[model samples]
Target chain A: MTAPAAVLDSPLRELSYAEAIRDALAIALAEDERVVLMGEDIGVYGGAFQVSGDLVHRFGEERVIDTPISELGGAGMAVGAALTGLRPIYEFQFSDFATLAMEQIVNQAAKLRFMLGGAVSVPLVMRFPAGSGTGAAAQHSQSLEAWFGHVPGLKVVQAATPYDAKGLLLAALDDPDPVMLFEHKLLYKTKGPVPEGRYTVPIGKAEVCRTGSNVTIVATAIMVHRALEAAEVLAQEGIDAEVIDLRTVRPMDRETVVASVAKTSRLVVAYEGVRTLGIGAEVSASIVESEAFDYLDAPIVRLGGAEAPIPYNPELEKAAVPQVADILSAVRGVVRGTR
Target chain B: MSISSETERCGAQAPAPGRKGSGGSARPASRRAGKTSAGNEPFAVRHYSPEVLREALRKMLLIRRFEEGAEDSYMRGLIHGTMHLSIGQEASAVGACLELTDQDKITSTHRGHGHCIAKGADVGRMFAEFFGKESGYCRGRGGSMHIADVDKGNLGANGIVGGGIPIAVGAALSAKRLKTGTVVTSFFGDGAVNEGSFHESLNMAAIWKLPVIFICENNHYGMSTSVERSTAVRQVSDRAAAYSMPGVTVDGNDLSAVAEACHGAIERARAGEGPSLIESVTYRWRGHSKSDRNRYRSKDEIDAWIARDPIRRFAGLLSEHGILSEEGFARMETEVAEQIAAAIAFAKESPDPDTAALTRDVYTTQTESVG
Candidate 1:
């Protein structure tokens, strides 16, 4: 029998982003009885994507409730439990399924606080494995963070690394407003250091994964990791590329991005969401709106998924979302003729 | 109660016409005291206990006072948002809630002040909610439509029409699975029965045998459309037969009858009897919200239903039972008036929530957060 993975390792131990998220949830549930997980096939089935693998055995069905295939129902149930003082961590089988529960998330959960004259809150965290990489096609693959980010009463976050996946989820579970945590399906296998003990990565705070003086590259979810890879390739070409992981999309850490752009003097925003009105557009506009635009060495570049439905074909799906090569090209183009 | 010249209210006394009964009887004029322009009438009465009778009267009066006060504040522009008043259908809320233990939970609708009060929420906090003050149950984050006092087992007053049904089903599932012996009662309107959530939740609850009581307050209209126009079966209770649950129609205006029906269902549920459906035939005295000037019904219909006022009927029963004399009933009314007056004063005097609190409780901090 394979023994369970070690938990006492240093915070930097290599682990898949999905494992890291599971670790974070385990630590959270172990620490508090109020924290419970609810979603379709999250328990006995070990999650459709296995993000909640082995949780049912550890927490039991009570803590890790396996619900019916009712997205709106599950979302509404989460809102109810949250309002009743339970910290509910709800999971959407896929980000695309979130559309079915939009009324609960957007109308009921999101607007509850504001409409109630700011009297009550929905202390709920909903995790949706988002973005296109797996040939899950249009219904299952869509980076719809912009849809949730546009809602005023909801906090939206996306995790690119094993570290942020674990930490941001922990943070989202703590927030009183409904929080939508977008996890890139492809990033699950990627490992990074995740602290063993309970800790939270603050929401709405951007992480500067790699520092450079040439160009500020702001990216979200899987795009953050791709940007980091592009930054590494850019470094070899004598082009210093700074990568900003937009861990939280709503109540975005604009200050961090603006400060980075002020130092780097060039900005490139990237995301897996569609190009039009996506997180990329929001970040680019923020840069132009801020005092940092005066220091821009070139026009702020925005790179995002093609403005089309995610295709079923593998090659088309790969081309739809920004890849390392695309980021590298975009960054190299921005840094060109600057010197 | 005496009307004061200082207060200018929206509704004026008008004789309602064409108010037909479920069985096609001519509506009584006295029952139409304050029916909104929608010619809806109060349903027939059920059995009443002496104590239950008084309790229902008090609660309904409380709702009436609360709504009257809310409308006053709303007209004055002191209340910021829209207020949905359950002025005429208090018996349904109180009667159903009476069957619930403190452990049992209720999911309310957008027009939910009556549900909150019946579920035992503090009147002061409810008032503070409308005032958008910090003392409100949600600390000003949740207003009237979202008031939730978990301690009182009121899940919340939902803003979306059919939103709370699923939550109640989940809570019922939790209760049954956890063996908590706590049933969940979901209060929605006839309008909500048409929602996809209503059907989905009912099917899930039935299949799971989750302990839930789906109380549809068929108050004759969903916003403006009459139940007759929307539903082929005039009696909303008939839908319960579709889910294979015992469907019973109760006089929502008669407090005792509602309590008896709910008590049987609640007891059966606690004993693992699965779920039941109770369609409370009722009417609304006010418009859907404070802003509505209901033009759907005639003056005769409005005047007719007011005559069958639940509060007045319950008071009459108490007098007939010799539980309380006319003077004693008057004293109860006076006490309720004073209590409500104090609640209003308390809300008026309560401090507003600090602006910084707007960001707090959105997430539980490690130092201050939940998880």
Candidate 2:
């Protein structure tokens, strides 16, 4: 059930997660005439995070459309375009803005194909800059990947690294169904080696970011980066924590996740979203419902964001989601039987 | 709030109460602003050749017979799932799509069978879809509310009221960007115009000058709630002013009038003048769904609208003009009835979907990396 590591041979470039996403968009735009970008302030404004810098000039305003400040309308247009012939990549200023366009995303884009008896496919990509730590407060900072993953037709993924941010975006664009790509706001500036040119990391395969034996920590979005950092700290403490970066939340690679859990009996699900009914719950259930259940040596634990809105206060924002120290301690507790 | 607006006193094809057309008394002093004098005229359909009018009549009749057939089948329990038939609003559906080429796209509402038929969908597959047959357009996946033919440029009908508005705008955006010369027609109902999606889509389309025609089939009800109960504006087209687009209200039962208004709007879109909103005020003779009894509406109200049946009115026009003889009209009606009958037979004989289909079409197991 294990997939080969998606190691690209193209020229390696150190790019931030935001830069990798922009590059992937540029590649998709250049390679195909059907692809177009639409979002608020993404064109001349260089995006909220400057992710799509100068794309307006390069692709022109036609292909790189600067839509009116209407998320619902823009998302609906993207669905319509996807329903017709063109492939549209829509961007939400923040993941929270998606709430305004929930009807379009949930009812229209997600259900069009199935509702139409599979007569058409909505080959649409929606980019959501999600997660917290920027002190954007309750309205701005939120992880709603689980909300979209809960839908039957949507392909929900959390791009953890620059390589994945680029590769997953391309993969999502290529996917025949609607794909919700959630990029953590904090990871925009985090740099990693990303391959150049046309390449994609298949959706639904969880990659083992840091392979270990004592415990398995399934992390999503920014938590994967945090889990990797926590793994380094746990390595020094003699606890080898296997970190599985759950790239895609839905159509979950249960086989890969179960295999990791079977390999490492102790399991810890880490996510920045709220713990209740989150991706962590799904991951926890995946192992509990399978043969991996009998292999569990201890009660599987979950370390996720607290059941509270992300506060504007920096300290509270840091406390909201599981930080490296929290992930490190959670794994330590599960591994050393400290409870 | 009263469900009736000042202009809600008449049926789709009826002349405004106490108001006349071009030859009648001068336009009302208190007449709702922004509506054109030309939009109130029913003779616009005569501007086209008799041939075009005959085809428009044929299209409307086809929708009428098709829905009647569907209704019969539904009653017989041959159709599994429920459907929203455009029984009384045939003119709006036909006229909106009357002039559209195969390259142009359309998105319909839950009451979309007429839209699909107008867009050249094969009735056999459409009936098959309603019967949940393997041969249906959606292969039994999308039933009545979900029938779509991408090849015919029908983007499929939406279950949500204002759902198709944005999609039509998107198709227009695609057309504008690709220089495809493809205009998109969006067909919704009175209830949909109030939806936030309508406002957002109109604003975007107006600003971008996307080739989109927004046809609001104002059937006087969003389920059971009337326009006065739902909207602040008297005419659904009045909302268009907020988005800087041209808006009009036309008699939806008059196919020629609906066709003429849509023709202007479609041409305006193709010419890159931006989107236009046309409120084709019509009525649904039937209930909202299979379960909906006529509790909210009075029997008199239903009878009044039914008297202005779009197909019957169009047939009268064609007959009056000598474009279609009485015999020809009867023959067309009989042919459509036979077509529906054949479709039902095809659906009844078709096999149920295999178990493997359960796991199929769900973007199954893609391991290949995109290059």
Candidate 3:
């Protein structure tokens, strides 16, 4: 058996988003006996997305538990276990299944602490395989991080990079309130540098993925990748597009986005969630609500998924959310003042 | 009071393992309050002493008076939000907690004031919670349905139907995993039995044999809809057969029957015999909520259920057993009324929650680390 990965400060080896999450799970299981993975098809199936691969064999069925296909029951049990001594990480095969567990998540988990006057807490973690482009259609491909972020007493984070994928999970495990961690379905196989052993990426912080001056593209999940790609293309056109990967949607890094918009004087918010009441509106409002409003050179362009439910067809699906080309066109329009 | 008469009323609905009754048996709890304790034998048939009987009556009485006061205050514009009172279903609520302690956990329904009181919640603080004051259990953030005293083993009541069912299963899971010797009871409305959570949680609990009891307070109606109209199944407990668990339906208006049934189920759960379901057939005396103007049910139907008021039946049982006299019952009534009145005054005098407290309890640590 491989020795549990050692703690190394220096970055070494690259892992895909799926592998990074598994590494974090291994660390959590090995380090803390109280941690358990509760979800459907996560154990023998190695997870529907294969994110929990091989850990079930190592941790045993008790720690890496397989649950019935009842999202409401599984999620509620996770919350209840958290209220007890156990730190349970619940997984939804798809983010859309969270609709079934909304009563437990929104009503029970979110309100338990406040309802009890802070006597007890639900130190629970819920993972969702979110975002579109898999052609999983409307039910499986939704990015519902905004729905969770809208609720109080919940910490919602989107892991874009492999480093943050592992680090943010470890951090959420440390949190006392229920935290919802959203991993983009499209970014599962995407690989990036991840440190060895356990490490934590601070929640509610945004990282500047690519620095530029013409426009600041604040993106989440898979949108961060599209924004970075668009920045690369715009760099050749003498349009230096700054990219800010907004990792956590709730308690957003308003200071960083506002500061970036102040410097670039233009902003383009990108996300895979529906256009109405998406994170884009909040980011734009935060900037407008602050001193960044006066520094805006152009109206903030919100690039979100289409208002309609995603069609099964791949072409229509591609048209739903902002792509690299769409980001480029929006950035070009704001930079050239053509709109 | 006699064995033959007791059997006549409760039938074979007790959780005696081998006991079974005809499907949908509706036993009318004796509405006659004059049946005094003279004809009953003491300490021979039941183990509970005269003191325990008095205490049970007292607890149910307190719940009744407290909720009545809350209703009065609501009408007077003192209690702000709406409250769902279990006035007529006190036995089903209190009887489930007869054998439970702080080591045990109970998740209650929206009509959970009785459950909270029966489980030893402070009446003053509960009143404060209903009034939305700082001294309440939730510090005024959560209203009637969300009121909780976790230290007392009362998990907060849920507003959503069937929401607390899974949490109870999870708690049972924790007890089993930790070997804590703790048991959990989930008290939900009849409507919740139809929800997916109820089915899923029951299945999981039965398979694990985790010490948990699913108690369905079958109050005959969910909001305005009758159980017969809403659900296809004739009996709520029959669903337990799907999970391979023992399902018992008892006369909820009879406190002794509820106690006997819950005590056995809880003991079996604690013995690692998995979960069981108890469908306590009862009725609600009040409207579903403040907005419920009693438009759906006729006054005659409401009067019939009110005739079967659980508090009155228990009072009759105690009187029939010779444990309670007319003067003794009257003194108990006055005592409960004063206690409720004091609680109301306490809630009225309590300060409003500090606005600064609203920011707290959101997370365990760190506001937002920008770096």
TM-score of each: 0.84, 0.92, 0.91
lDDT of 3 by residue, A30-72 (tens): 9998899989899989999999988889999888888988899
Q: How are the candidates ranked when ordered by lDDT, highest leading?
A: 3, 2, 1
- Report the CA-based lDDT of candidate 3 relative to the real structure: 0.84
**Native A-B contacts reproduced, model 2:** 0.67
Clashing pairs in 3: B36-B319, B36-B320, B37-B319, B37-B320, B37-B321, B37-B322, B209-B274
| lDDT (Cα, tens digit) per residue for candidate 2, span B1-371 | 11111223222334522222321111132122223344353343445777777777777777887888889989999888788878888888887888888889999889999999999888888888888888888888778988888889998888787888998998888888788998999998888877889888898888888899888888888888988788887777777778787777767776766776777787788889888888787888888998888788899888887766667766765665567787787777777778878877888888877756663454434342220
User: Rank by DockQ, descending?
Assistant: 3, 2, 1
Give the TM-score of chain A, superposed on the true chain A, for all candidates in the order listed: 0.94, 0.97, 0.97
- Which 10 successive residues of model 2 chain A have the least lDDT summed? A1-10
Candidate 3 docking classification: medium
lDDT of 1 by residue, A1-339 (tens): 011245334445778899999998998899888788989899978998899999999989888988878888888777877765578899999989999889888888877655555445678899998888889899999988899988777788888888778878877776667788988888888888776765678888889989999999998877887888888889899999889988888878888999999999999899988898878788888888889989998887788889799999999989998889888887877789542
Model 3, position B157, has a per-residue lDDT of: 89
Q: What is the C-alpha lDDT profile of model 3 across B1-371, one tens digit per residue? A: 11112222222223222223412322222111112143543221274777878888889999988888989999999888798988889888888898799889999989999999989999999999888899998888888989888988988788889988999999998998888899999999989988999999998887778789889998888998888889887688777778888777777776776776777688888899988888888878898998899888899887877766667767766776677887788889889888998899999999988886775665555485321
Scoring model 2 with DockQ, what do you get? 0.50
DockQ each: 0.25, 0.50, 0.54
DockQ of 1: 0.25
I-RMSD for candidate 3: 2.6
iRMS of each prediction = 5.1, 4.2, 2.6
The DockQ-derived docking category for candidate 2 is medium
